[model samples]
Target chain A: MSRLKYDDVETGATIPERTFPVRRLDLVRYAGASGDFNPIHWNERFAKSVGLPDVIAHGMFTMAEAGRLITDWTGDPGSVVDYSVRFSAPVVVPDDDQGAEITVGGKVKSKNDDGTVTVMLTARSAGAKVLAKASAVVRLA
Target chain B: MAINPDYLGREYPAPEVYEVTRGKIREFAEAIDDLNPVYLDRASAKAMGHPDVIAPPTFPVILGMAGSALAIADPDLGVDFSRVVHGDQGFHYSRPLYAGDVLSTVTRITGIKALGGNELLTLETVAEAADGEHVVTASMMLVVRGS
Candidate 1:
């Protein structure tokens, strides 16, 4: 799929926000996919034993959600050339109504001379920025 | 719980060769809901100058952590798995990972510091192809809360 060219983008351009509800089952599926069988991620009893308030989502899973936010916005997930982030906090997956709502949005920070755009992202959960300082560099196709 | 600052600078053995395949890469891409064709289509990847299907930039973490987990999960390392939280992760790539490449990673404990009631352990994993070409470096920071 053809993607947005870097020259076509402008600084301060905001990608539409995308939200993913993280549920208990998502964590189970992620555990199987990731092989990170940490009890804090899926086993409530084990999490309690370890002092975690409840089952938490894996950092990678959260990162993926943030990544999807960027890719989904750019209209081409493959446009992403380089991405990095600081995991600021945990996304605790509540078994209740609200669950873990991961809201992602991004702003085009700069259009590089090398035909790439630097995008800054914000992933929030529980009213706090979960993936803070998230940024990616995408090459326009 | 306490993480020994002395554990800093310890390097772990490189992981065994992990051959990148379209299937595993596809599964990971699916899990992330990423529909990037270059990640699974060899033809598309080749057109982009990649040897084969390219793995997603984040996929290396799967293999990178295998080597670092030994140190992070070590009970003697003073990390209380019960109170541990993944704090941050960052990656620097020399080149994209492509299918059919045999990759290995060398993990090192980059830093250890106490953050008031918690201890933060930082690890850097460098993934290299069999030919000794650098592929990616993944940096992960885990914070273990003290009781």
Candidate 2:
């Protein structure tokens, strides 16, 4: 898939926002697949024993979900050349069908001469920011 | 217990070979709730210039964490495995990882510091192809809480 062209992208253009549902079952699957096996992501009791409010989503899981926000915008996952994020807050997942909701939004920060664009992202969960200074450098068409 | 600041500057050799495959990539993609066709369909991935299905940008975290075992698992590091939490992550890609690529990662302890009774350790992992070409660098921060 061809990525968004650098010429067509304008600075400050807002990418469409997206919200993802993170449930305990999703956490289990993520743990199995990612090999994180962090109990704070799946076992509420263990998480509580460790001082977490509840079972929390893996920081990498949250980051990957937010990264889809950038790839989805470009229509190509490989176009993302550099991606980084700081885990600011935990996404506490309750034992429920509804679980937790993480909403991701982004804006084109700048179009570099190197055929890439810097995108600044904002990710929030439960009304608190979960990722800080989140951004990615995407190669455009 | 606190993370062993003494381990700073330590470099761990690459672990066993990790081969990129469609199955692992697909599983990881689904786990992240991303259903990008290029991660599953070879023809579609070829259409985008990759030899085969390409893993997501963050997929290297799997290998990165595996490389962590080389250091974080060391008893002398003083890491309370139970208290460790991911602090941040950064991925700089030399090229997109696709199916059939074999990779190895070398991990180094680059930074160690304390904050609010927590010890933060920085791991800089560089993944290289068999030919010794760099693939991606996964810079991860791990916070080990002090009791």
Candidate 3:
């Protein structure tokens, strides 16, 4: 993987879009790894009891999936100096084999004087915006 | 009960060292279904100029969560964990975290606000290296639903 040079990126450059599949099993794995046992992420009954349509994906999991898009594009996890997102909607994952999908896309919003580029991200699940004001600052060679 | 507004600006003691390992990084990467070699393969990471396998951008949340647990579980805070849900998350990193790093975090309650019967609490966790070099600052907003 080659490093993305700061001089090569334009303010409007588009970061390739990517989609992540979210299954119930993925939520279980993430819960174990992140130590977030919020029943809303796994227990459909509990989630619905809370007024949610179904078991929703962990907000952190959705955030991570969006982060993967930037990391993969830059070819270096270290390139990401900052990341943020507001959970606007839940990525509801049903108890089914198909689960759901979160589609991520981004564009270089700005090129900082310090050789860092600000990328504005968009994450949607089930045709609804799941993350808003999503962005990442990445350092380039 | 609503979150104690007086606890705003309260800071918790730094958490014990959180040692980053290849296995943990791998687990996190796999959990997110992120197959980036930089998070799992040292050779691949080296080729990209990192000292070792680097963690995903959000990996700091794992360490930050541990530090936040102190505040969430504090009796004085008056937070109802049963109704809490994640609202927002953000991280500012001075450098990417890598396997073999030992980190510690200090958590502080930054803000408390109530909107339409829902309580929102903001927490800021600063994670530093064992030597006290700042690594990342994480901000999280947790919303506790109204009964």
Candidate 4:
């Protein structure tokens, strides 16, 4: 991992935006790994029964994708001292057309004197914020 | 059947300590298709000044669900597994969870309410290290559609 220097990042610097397409198989694997077997993530019948338009992706799955964006920008995932996020909307995984497009982006919110920087992040799908009030604190070297 | 709102503030015993490991972090990263080096290589983590390969920020989802899993799955909770949908989730971290940290979560039912005919259960789970230091806190809102 390339070390991100605390001196190099300027407040308001924006991380390059990244887009990841989530598929049903991705949700299946996540369900297995996370031990969350909710059929809303796999069975369309169950999802519709629960009032979801279709099978929806786990919120954590979206969170992980957003996390990848942060680690990618910081160059060192371990440098993140704190991370927090609020779920705003469900990333509905439709059975047809291009899957859910999760676009992740972040901008430096503040440069702290203690060598820590705050990043404000946003993850959107279908032109809506799937994750909101997202932010992370990275302790730079 | 609806869960009694009066049952709010019910706390469940914490789950056993789950020791975070580089292998698990790597597996989680791979499962998520996140190839971040700090979650795989300790050398890279060292280069980044971490004590060890650190798990992803959302890795606590697994650890945090231990206590609430029992509550939500309880037959008495009246939660219909077939009709429930994950409504929302939020996480707040006091510190980044690193490999080798033995942590456990204590989950509590903070609120149980009726929304129309469905049940909304709010859970707050707090994770702590074996040394008794707070690690992370996660709040989840689950909506169980009534039959």
Best candidate (score: TM-score): 2
Predicted complex 1: CAPRI docking category: acceptable
| Candidate 1 lDDT over residue span A40-101, tens digit each | 98887887777777888888888888887666556554466678888887788978766788
Question: DockQ scores for all the models shown?
Answer: 0.49, 0.87, 0.88, 0.51
Query: Candidate 2 vs candidate 4: which has greater DockQ?
Result: 2
lDDT of 3 by residue, A87-124 (tens): 99999998889999999999999999998999999999
| Global local distance difference test of model 2 | 0.91
Stretches off by above 4 angstroms in model 3 are none
Q: Judging by TM-score, tell me the better candidate of 3 and 4.
A: 3
Candidate 2 runs further than 4 Å off: none
Clashing residue pairs in all predictions, respectively, total: 0, 0, 0, 0
The local lDDT score (0 to 100) that residue A113 gets in candidate 4 is 84
TM-score of each: 0.89, 0.98, 0.97, 0.86
Ranking by DockQ: 3, 2, 4, 1
> In model 4, which runs have C-alpha deviations exceeding 4 angstroms?
A96-98, A112-115, B113-120, B145-147
Candidate 1: true contacts recovered, fraction: 0.41
Which of the predicted structures, 1 or 4, would earn the higher DockQ when compared with the native? 4
Q: What TM-score does candidate 3 get on C-alpha atoms?
A: 0.97
Lowest lDDT sum, 10 consecutive residues, model 3 chain A, at: A68-77
Interface RMSD of 1: 2.4
